[model samples]
Target: MTNKKKTTIKDIASVLNISAAAVSKALHNDSRISDKTKIAVRQVAKNLNYQPNHLASALRSGKSNLVGVIVPKTNSNFFSSVIENIEQVLNKEGYNIIITQSNESFKKECDSIDTLLFTQVDGIIASMANETTDLVYFKKIKKNGIPLILFDRGENNLNVDYVGIDDYASSSLIVEHLVNQGCKRIAHIGGYKRTRIFNNRIRGYVDALNKFNLPLDKELLIESSLTIEDGRAKMQQLLALKNKPDAVYVAGDYAALGAQQVLLENNIKIPQEIALVGFGNEPFTAMLTPSISSINQHSDEIGKKAAEAFLVHAKNSSFTQTLNKIILNAELIIRDSSNKKNQ
Candidate 1:
């Protein structure tokens, strides 16, 4: 069997009876090309299944028109939705995006940044991993003159463009709602304090508890990666306490789901026995047996804003402009899990 030759711009040009330069201009939709020629070039290019040599174009123009996105995990609704929206915005601007996951590992996150830089991506938008404490890798991106934007898990210390919801206020909203449900003793299952968003949530949880005059029980507060397994382990620890909490507020939906599973396995009724609330308003949270109350982080808006931030940096030659920090408000979504009075 003979291997078929890949179609190129010259092939499309030959088929269309036009010069290779004309084909290139037509493909790029150059203003110099007539509309009739542009339409014919595109149709013939499509018929020939022509693919542009992006690498060659990048070498000539010094702009790859490619963006890189790094996230902790893509399986979650929040990250997936954010990625989808980012793609939507970037695609319209003639830019393609490469998504990489760090799996919440700092070493992997550093590797991803290196890979993106090696690929010569125009810019990078990322959410830092849980274990990422050092900003040296991110600083390298800036040193190399690459536009860097962060979302969800961002740091003010980096002084880069950021788009995310106000986590501390979201936590306060959760505490207020749980208090309204008459939960006297509330437990918090949150992410590690090293992460900015989680630390803000923890602070908000403590301050909110103080605002309500509730006793601060150190035993009821646990810090982990907020994964499903960690959620189960933390919930189990809370259950073993001498005075168990009447309500639990987990900083992640996956963790909340794990806590709910543990409660159901132990035959403890939700809301009636102990209320539950989660963050990130994941789709499955509503589909669960006892739908969990959660905070909607506005994933779509966050994604769009993050993409726009990249565009801003990409267009500006001087990176000296004031950094854009967009903070969206999170909404408290009440559901069966924490709606004891309503249920």
Candidate 2:
């Protein structure tokens, strides 16, 4: 079987007995081209099964209409929800997205950035990896003159557009609730201090403890990768202490689950013996045997705002000069793990 010739502007022009330029203008609905000519050209193009070369068109317009999104991981409900909302908003604006996951690896994040740049995306929206301390890779995105918007996991040092929840306030809320429950010796299983959000949460936790006139015990404050395995290790470390904490607050839901597993394995009662709280309000937080208390980061709102931030920069071309920061308040969802009063 022989290959069929692809239809082009000349093919439509030949059918209409018009110049190829006129056919091109008509297909694009240029104001100079008559509506009658446009109608005829479109009908002929459809009959010829003409498919527009979007890449060529995009090159001519200097816009791909494609955005790249990077996230640490997608298995978590929070990141997945954020991605869903980002796609919904961008699709409505005639833009498409390419999503990439870093799996919390810095090298993987750098590779994702390189891949997105290679694709010539109009803009990028990202949530940084746990190990992304160096901002050099992010600077490469800025040097390319494309808008970069970050969410959930970001650094102020990048000085680009960002949308996220008030992590500091969320931590404070957890401390206040635990304080009200008469937890004097509280422990914190938090993320690495290198990450901005986790640093803010650490600061908030420390200040909240001070505000309540509680002792700032260094042993109780452990910086981790925020993985479930690390959470179990940290929790075990806490349990080995002669003076164990009465309550524990974890920086992530998965880590909190790991801590819960350790507590249960040791026959320690939840909420009664050791209260617990986690951040990000993952669905499983409420599904466990002893439902975990967590902070609601408003994943949908964060996603929408992050997409909108990228749009603003893409339209205005001002991300290089004017930085946009949108921080939403977080809500604490009280549950069985931290509700000592009910227990």
Candidate 3:
């Protein structure tokens, strides 16, 4: 097969025997260009298989209809759902999304930002990885007039646009729900490093226990990476303790699932003996034998809101700020795992 050269706007202009500027105006649907001319230009552009040069177009209009989206990991269900919603919003707005995953690596996250900068994306929407700390890279972008919006995982210091649920409040609600169910001795699992999300969750857990006059037992605290294996390992350790906790608050559903599997394998009864609560209402959370109680952060809504923020900021290139902070609400999903009678 003969490799054909990529068609450019100039090719469409030549095919139409018109000025490049006219073709550009038609592509942008400028009112100056009549509807008849716009149709003609579009038809020629399509026939030539012409694709506009985004960089040159950006240079001409001083705006790029490209948004960069960086997420910790594309493999997670929640992140995947968020990205899907974000893309839908941006697509409808006549914008393209440049997506990359950092895989929870700080260095990779930094590199991803660098690449987006080089691409000259009009705006950036990101969820920082677990290992990210120095947000100075993002700060420099905003300093240079690039719009940055953070959703999900974020840096507290950067005062750019951010949209997410109050982590501490949601965590408190979940822990309080478990405690209200008569879970006197409870344990927690799957807190990663020193990220604000996990830290706030820890605070919520501590605050809830203190409110209920439950002693913060050292044996009940199990910190592990949020993963299936880690959850299973932590759950095993919790089970081995001289005093096993009566209830567990897990950070992620996948880990919660792994822990549940261990409990079942040991013939431990759920809720009746050991109650459980989980975060991130992943698909499997509802499908399991005992539905998993979780804090619903509305992953898709987070993504859509993030995209909307990016678009709003992109429109106001001259310091036209839209929303500073949009804190969505999280719902506590009560399920069989946490409700004894429901089981």
Candidate 4:
């Protein structure tokens, strides 16, 4: 059996009765080429199943026209939505994106950076993993002079472009809303303090409690990985306390869902007995039986800003080192879970 040869631009040029250079220019949408010839070249390329040699193009032009995006998890609606918007903005500029999930692993994130670099990607936009405390691997990207942008879970130490919502203010908003609903003894189930965003949320929760003249009860503030299982376990622990909290504020929606499940299993009436609020306005938050109250992080806006930041860096040779931080304000979405007065 004979193996088939791969289709190339030359094949498309031959079929369209045009020079290979003209076909290349047409593929790139050069203004010098007539629209008629460009359309013909594209049609013939499609018919011949011709694939452009991106690696060769990158070597010749010093640009891969490819962007790398790293997220903690792609399964979540927030990350997936952000990725979609990023793709939309980048694709219009004739750039493609490669998405990689770290699954909250430091080693995996490092591996992903190495892989993207090996592929000669023009830039990398990433949200740091939960386990990524060391910034050595991140520094390597800068050392190689590749444009690096961090979003959501970012580090202040790294002077790179960043785009994310104001997590600290979001936490304060949640606390204020719960207080308005007459929740005095509010407990918080938040992410680990080592992560910057989680640390900000924890500080906001503490400050809000103090501002309301509520005691800073050590028993009421717990830190975890913020998974659904962690939420269930943390909620159970809160329930076992001698004086249980009247309300719970979770740092993540998935964990909040788990807490709600535990509450349902225990036959506890929501808002009436124990109010709840979650961060990250996931779709399921509103679709649940007694819809959950959550904070909208504006994933779409964050994605767009991140993509635009990459484009700016790619276009300007000297702008990579310039610090550009875009912080968006998050809005709170009220629902049945925490609406005590409406109940």
Candidate 5:
């Protein structure tokens, strides 16, 4: 069996009885080419199943027209939606995305950045890994003069464009809802304080408890990576306490799911024995036995804003000195787990 030769501009030129250069200009929609020739070139190119050489075009134009997107993980609906929106916005502007996942590993995140750079992407949009703390690797991106936009899990000290929700306000909203449900001894299963968003949530949780005149017990405030396993361990620790919390607010939905599993295994009634809530209104939160109350992060908006931020830099040759910090308000989604009235 013989491999078919890939169709080229020369093939279209031969079919249309025009110069290869004419075909090239027509394919690119160059102003020098006539409309009739351009239409003829496109029709023949389609017939031949011609594929444009993007790499060659990038080499000639000095712009790859490719964007890199790095996320901690892509399995969650929130990240998935964000990515979808980012692609949608970028695609309209004739740019494509190269996606990479860090799996919450700092080394892996660094590797992803390196790989994206190697690919000669026009810009990068990323959400930092949970294990990411060192800014040197992130600083490298800026050092290269590539546009870098961070969303959700980002470091402010890096001084780049960032798009995320008001995590502190979201946490306060969750606490207020729980307090309204008659929860006094509210516990928090939160992410690490080193992460900006988690730190904000922790601060909000503490302040909201104070605002409502509830006991701000140090024993009840525990920090972890906010993974499902972390949630299970933290929830177990909370359950073993002599004075158990009347409510538990987990910083992540996966962690909240783990906490709910532990509660079910122990035959503890949800909302009655202990109300439960989670962050990032994941779809599974509503599908649980007692639907988990959560905070909506507005992933679509974040994705769009992040992509737009990158475009702001991409369109302008001169970099903007002012950093874009888009902080959107999050909404509380009440469900059976935390809504005592509904329960």
Candidate 6:
């Protein structure tokens, strides 16, 4: 004969000869219940294996306590750190997380948003895909009364909570550092500037050169797909130029890695014949043959601020009425790659 299924609250109450409410109160440690009765009820519940249904309770309370988060690129270290931090904060606040990566596709991003909404998420946090221009697609979240928090790479025109660093200032900082390194003729390898972050960096690069009275050489400015292979091609094209750059500023380290590899293949000296600086101080930067100098994106703090913003919106009933942007500060990380002394 098969054993019967585990007992429910009703079974516990029946065995104890008391009301289901009494058993529940006793299990929840209600002060109204006498100490003797609470002990007896708890013992009976333990014996009968009564379990409260949290999902049913949440449904009755009109709260799922679930947050949906979407990111464009997840392979990078910065994204990994941001997700871990968001998880830490959400877990502490007794909320659950649903994570999805869009891989920089608008269609996939939209589909992910739909799935999250279908799952009854209370709120959403997202980093827009590089190719995403249809901000109105996310208007459904607002229509459903869900607060959307956008972080890192996001839109300024949209009405949503945003947390990120001032990429413009950070870009300027890196440019100034390159200038101070005695590189008068500097070239920039630009990433996909359609995204807010890359565009800000490109602007910063141009502004710095103009401020320094250095002409923006069209030949020296190279556009990259932000991949190693693409960066290698950009570097090769630059090397063929009549006047090669003394210093090159790359937007992403993954591209820089490809460029560095090409430079070695061509016997191009780093920081000697050509200095290199990159954004996103990735872990591999420090371990490379010549450590890459880069802008510290403050990814950990960005995640922390995102968590704080989520808490603010989730806890405050008037959050929808109040809108504010939180921008974090970033600094330059000097390493062997950009140091003239390294050679």
The lDDT for every candidate, in the order shown, is 0.92, 0.93, 0.85, 0.93, 0.92, 0.84
Residue pair clashes in candidate 6 = none
Runs of candidate 5 exceeding 4 Å displacement = 14-17
Q: Write the per-residue lDDT of candidate 1 for residues 1-343, one digit (tens) a residue.
A: 6978888889988887889999999988999999999999999988888888878888999999999999998999999999999999999999999999999899999999999999999999999988899999999998888999999998668878889898889889999999998999999999989889999999999999999999899998899778899899899989998899999999999999999999999999899989999999999999998999999999999999999988888878676635678999999999999998776
Runs of candidate 2 exceeding 4 Å displacement = 1-6, 20-28
Q: Residue by residue across 1-343, what tens digits does model 4's lDDT show?
A: 6867888888988887889999999998999999999999989888878888878888999998999999999999999999999999999999999999999999999999999999889999999999999999889999999999999998568899989988888889999988998888999999989999999999999999988888988999999898999999999999999999999999999999999999999999998899999999999999997899999999999999999999898889786465778999999999999997777
Model 4 vs. true fold: TM = 0.91
Instruction: Indicate whether candidate 3 or candidate 4 has the larger lDDT.
Output: 4
C-alpha TM-score for every candidate: 0.92, 0.93, 0.91, 0.91, 0.95, 0.91
lDDT of 2 by residue, 1-343 (tens): 6879888889999999999999989976799999999999999999999987778889988899999999999999999999999999999998999999999999999999999999999999999998888899999999999889989898577778889999888889999999998899999999999899999999999999999999999999999988899999999999999999999999999999999999999999999999999999999999998999999999999999999888887788554635678999999999999897776
Q: Is candidate 2 or candidate 6 better by TM-score?
A: 2
Q: Clash number for every model?
A: 0, 0, 0, 0, 0, 0
Off by over 4 Å in 4: 1-51
Poorest 10 consecutive residues of model 1 by lDDT?
315-324
Output the worst ten-in-a-row residue range by lDDT, candidate 6.
316-325
User: Model 3 — which ten-residue stretch has the worst lDDT?
Assistant: 314-323
- For residues 210-292, what per-residue lDDT tens digits would candidate 5 score against the true structure? 99988789999999777888899999999999999989999999999999999999999999999999999999999989999
Best by TM-score: 5
User: Candidate 1: what lDDT?
Assistant: 0.92
Q: Would you give me the overall lDDT of model 2? A: 0.93
